[model samples]
Target: MKARDLIVLVGVIGIVLMMVLPLPKMLLDILLIINISMALMILLIAMNTKEALEFSIFPAILLITTLFRIALNVSSTKLILGEGDAGEVIKTFGEWVSQGNIAIGLVVFLILVVVQFIVITKGSERVAEVAARFTLDAMPGKQMAIDADLNAGLINEQQAKERREKIESEADFYGAMDGASKFVKGDAIASIVILIINLVGGFIIGMAMHGMPFKDAANTYSILSIGDGLVSQIPALLISTAAGLIVTRSATKGNLAEDLSTQMLAYPKLLYIVAGTIAMLGLFTPITVMSTLPFAAILAYAGYRMQQNLEQKAVSEEQLEEEQQIEEVRSPESVINLLQVDPIEFEFGYGLIPLADVQQGGDLLDRIIMIRRQCALELGLVVPVIRIRDNIQLKPNEYIIKIKGNIVARGELLLNHYLAMSPGYDDDSVTGIETMEPAFGLPALWVDEAMKERAEVSGYTVVDPPSVVATHLTEIIKKHAHELIGRQETKGLVETVKEQHPAIVEELIPNLMNIGDVQKVLANLLREKISIRDLVTIFETLADYGTYTKDPDILTEYVRQALARQITQQYSIPGETLRVITVGPTLEKKIADSVQQNEQGSYLAMDPGTTQQVFQRFQEQIGRLVQSGYQPIVLASPGIRMYLRQLMERTMQDIPVLSYNELEPNVEIQSVGVVNV
Candidate 1:
């Protein structure tokens, strides 16, 4: 065993032995001073711990210290009664606290008992019990979140395991603390009992055995009892306070002093208010000027200094940013850097800067964070960090959205105005500048504050500038989501699946298919606005069919059939019949025959005349579906579904095309219209 380990084992045994052994005055005094010093060290260590887990051994330490103090008490009691004196340590404590008055010393010792036992110990015990219960209750939820992140490719297997372990440690620590607190409580009660016995027993012994008078016996024993109690109880008080600090400590980046100063003195304005209030007390109240003036001046000085520091910090950050930009422009690798592109980018003109600037009340940045979370939940796609910047070449109110460094959509906004779409019919009184809502291309007007309330009352959909921008950006991302995912992103998803469902990934990847093949399959599903969130089922389907075919198109069809329930839920109402446009016998037969195969893959080889005919018929059916307020879903047979989708993908990319096999058996499908040539 290690020396440190052996020393700890021996020290615990020695603490127990100290209760039975008799000691000389000098040796006893050394032990008593060591007891006080250890207690102070424990308190300092507790104060410096950033979290309770950082001091996980505190419960064991608490038990050992309580035992040590109890042993010291028993030894002192024996010495005071048998020898008529404990030690120089006890005698000095007795004399110093009493100052020749035993009654005052008794009062002081009782007060320490009340503070440690009733206040600190009781509070610490209750806190430990509550913290233990809460930590256990949160365990399942924390574990589920870890699994979710692992599946989402947000964290690796090792990270998830570490997080789970930390949660367990938290529960165990608090539970141990709950039980160890009783030791301190029992020690407090024992200290009071021991003090009473020492005083009473010593008095009787002094008169009966030593032949002393009542006055002399009482005087001699009272000082010894008070002194013993004071020495023991003071250290007990310190240990109990340390226990409270450990139980109440939460996870923080810094120690107690740093957290207290950083959080409490965070707001300079609050400090200024406090200083002014203290100054007013001196000016108008009965409090003396000298008493309040010094404190008020100190507070005022602190606030002023804090404000200056904040301004200096802002200036330093701006200078640093400017220097970095200049260095980047001057470097030879600047051209290489320019070749890289962000997955998504949002650039706005000067007039719309406030929409991204936090100080100007812009919540655009916060909304984008929510947007990423929403996309992750809905589409099972991890949207990258959106690079936002200002473009000087654009108009003042103009903003553009980009995908892979190419501009995809642009819109203008008046930040102070609301975009109000009309309620089927226009109200003559509600008026502003005419415009178009960019997301859906609906006719709308930019109305100021005065017209906003009136428009809402008139049944118009009133939306602020930020909401307009957010809605447009969300739609753009959803439309172009397929372009954002690639082989690297697919590897992340594959690795995530390997953490939990290893068998499926190992069977399919490298042997039957590779990362690029999987990426294509996922992109194909996302192109039609299908969610890839249920990756387990998707991987299972791929593993079952990947050996038979290498085509992503064929593989996506198989995967879609596996996710029939999810796809059905996406398009079908709970009880209502699914209304769709069905391909007629003539179109299906033509599409089936037009599907030609080659070395690369299959292609629709229909002539222009037949293709134009099919397009016109589709337009007629889709227009009617839109007029009737039904989504335009093209339902076709399984064999020709892929071909039919390929024919219309370029012109009607937003519309969903479903195969009959993709629908659930329970859903009732009604063909509202049929398309044929």
Candidate 2:
């Protein structure tokens, strides 16, 4: 072990030895001096510490010091009863400090006990107990504040972690102090009992064993015992005062001395009042003028000087602020910093501010977080943090969602009203203003709060204003999630995969296909509203077919076929036939024939008129399937699926176009409609 550690270990062992083994007079004196010195050191350190957490080891120190003092008491009691001379320190305290009077020494020792045990120890224990309770109660709030700061970008992850750890430490420190205070209380009680035992036992031993008379033995042993008690109680009192200071200390940027000087003497007016009071007392009361004049004069002069210093400090601070503002204006980088844009922004009008404000019972921020988590689970992509702010240019009840600084969706809401939409059946009985749902463009009405129950009873889905906005925002993010996935996000996903399947990642990344190629493939899947949550299967498919082609679209198709079960489960209901629209033999043949290949890539080479005709027929078929109450999914051959999807993307973005190979074997496919040309 290191020297410091060995010394500490030896010191602890020595404390144990003091209780059991008798020591020489010189050694006992040395230990007594050391105990006094250690207690003073602890008191000074506690006073200087700015925060309790800075002295987190204080509880253990308190325990060790209490034991050390107790051991000293034991040794002193043994010597006084056995040999009539405990040590020079104790004998000198008895003879010189107490004026050779046993009664005087006993009174002094009892006063110290009362001050340490009744005043300092009792108060410190109460404060520590209450502080520990308050700290524990406020822990959840402190943790939430840290989380809020982290979410608002006020602090980074590491800083948040540090703050959380500090909070836990503060709780633990106060709790330990609460228990450690009891040790001090016990030590005080033990001191009183030990003193009685020392005096009684010493008197008995002096008369019976050493042949001394009753009065002589009483005086001699009582003086020594009171001296030892005073010696121990003085340090205990100092240590108790230190414990009180520590537990009651508030968190500040400076030590106790600095805080007291700065705060207590902050105002010169208070000192002026004190000076006036002292002068008034001297004149009116029977106090001599000479006695109080100097003190009053000193107070008046100090107050005047403090007032001057305060003015000068204010002037200096103003000048510094002005200089800082001028420098900020002169720096070109300050102007350039304003050009930065957020990845996703949510702008609401003034009236809609209450929807985002927590004080008004709005949980829009929390809902947005849940939306991001839901998207990550369903779409397998991390949604960017949505920055919400108020924009006065829009209508009072209007809000908009922006992706990369461009508005993608806008909606209007009535804060006090609920949006109610019919579930396919017509319900005109509920009276309200007619509107359209921004998310799906479905016909909806803004109904009164009193009409919510009636509307729901009428087979209409009822939603609040915040839920309306949240639903709209959720849809917009899912639709544009592909654009949110950049190279950095792709790298994070690769690293995440690498953590679990390192061999697969090493074999595929930068060897067969780079990160960009993998990103494109993932983006393509996301663009089709496919979940990339099964990244292991995705990477394995890429590694197998990536050697043949570097095209992201082709790679996406391979990945989709590999994830056939997931894709099938996504669209089809369990134990039910999958109703879909299909392309006829003639149209399929035409689409297959139109497929062409070049050095760049394979693409559709069909004429515009024929493509238009095919799209019209496909739309008609989809409309018929929708009218029959079946959600339409187009199933095409593998060769023409991508081309057909590209043709219909602009018009039928919601309808998924899947290839035949993408379907699972156990799922039954029922052809509800077919496109003919």
- What's the lDDT of the predicted structure labeled candidate 2? 0.91
Model 2, span 1-677: residue lDDT tens: 99999999998999999899999989999988988998899899988998998889989999999999999999998899989999999888787757967778888888888888899999999999999999999999999999999999999999999999999999999999999999999999999999999988998899999999999999889888987987788788888988998998985788888998899889998888898899988999999888787899999999999999999999999999999988987998789866878889999999999898999998999999999999999999999889999999999998988999999989899999999998998776788989999999999999998889999999999999989988999999989989999899999999999999999999998899998999999998999899999999999999999999997888888999999999999999999999999888898888878888888778878888988898799888888989998888999988778888877886778889999999998999999888867
Task: Give me the runs in candidate 1 sitting further than 4 Å from their true place.
Answer: 1-17, 53-57, 134-172, 278-286, 306-346, 352-388, 397-401, 408-598, 601-677
- Per-residue error (Å), model 1, residue 657: 14
C-alpha local distance difference test of each model: 0.92, 0.91
Give per-residue lDDT, candidate 1, residue 82.
94
lDDT per residue, candidate 1, 72-164, as tens digits?
998888899998988888888888988988888899999999999999999999999999999999999999999999999999999998999
Which stretches of model 2 miss by more than 4 angstroms? 1-46, 49-101, 110-331, 596-600
Best prediction by lDDT: 1
**What TM-score would candidate 1 get against the native?**
0.63
